[model samples]
Target: MQKVTLRFSHNNPSCLPDYRNHSRSLKKVLQELNIPTWQRKRIPFLYYDDELVAAIGFFVCQAYVLQESEPSLHITWAS
Candidate 1:
């Protein structure tokens, strides 16, 4: 069985994704929009005509926490 592993470092509280194999990151995406990368709770979400365009990943805070299990990621793409 193939098992996936998530590295959780106690040194850094923020759970950042591993970018070793990733080409484009959140910072790269936001750079296209000319937004500065800052540690914040509310990230800049793009919306068009009341609809979510894309997630640039300029999040300000953690979305949520789970009690006994891994938290589910929910993206609100407005329409």
Candidate 2:
């Protein structure tokens, strides 16, 4: 069976490449969003079979994004 997971971690650094094909600093992204330091660690990360797909409020990884006409999983995060 295929497995998809949503997990939260405070240690995911920017070394992971983003959908844009470049490394994005999670720290900077959070700061830009005005997410207070205290709340940054509470953000969730979406993973697909162990690959990082998204950093909840920030961005989704390229390999996991859906193309036009493709089936997709709709996700929502509630505070």
Best by TM-score: 2
Off by over 4 Å in 1: 1-23, 39-41, 44-79
RMSD of 2: 3.0
Clash counts for all predictions: 5, 0
Q: What is candidate 2's lDDT per residue for 1-79, written digit by digit as tens?
A: 7787877674555634353556666676567668888786777877767667787878776666679989876877888
Colliding pairs, model 2: none
TM-score to true structure, per model: 0.23, 0.65
> Across residues 1-79, which tens digit of lDDT does each residue of candidate 1 receive?
4332222111223222223233344455346557544532235443333333334353322222234577555655333
Regions of candidate 2 where Cα sits further than 4 Å from its true position: 10-19, 24-36
Local distance difference test, each candidate = 0.36, 0.69
lDDT of 2: 0.69
What is the Å distance of residue 56 in model 1 from its true position?
7.5
TM-score of 2: 0.65
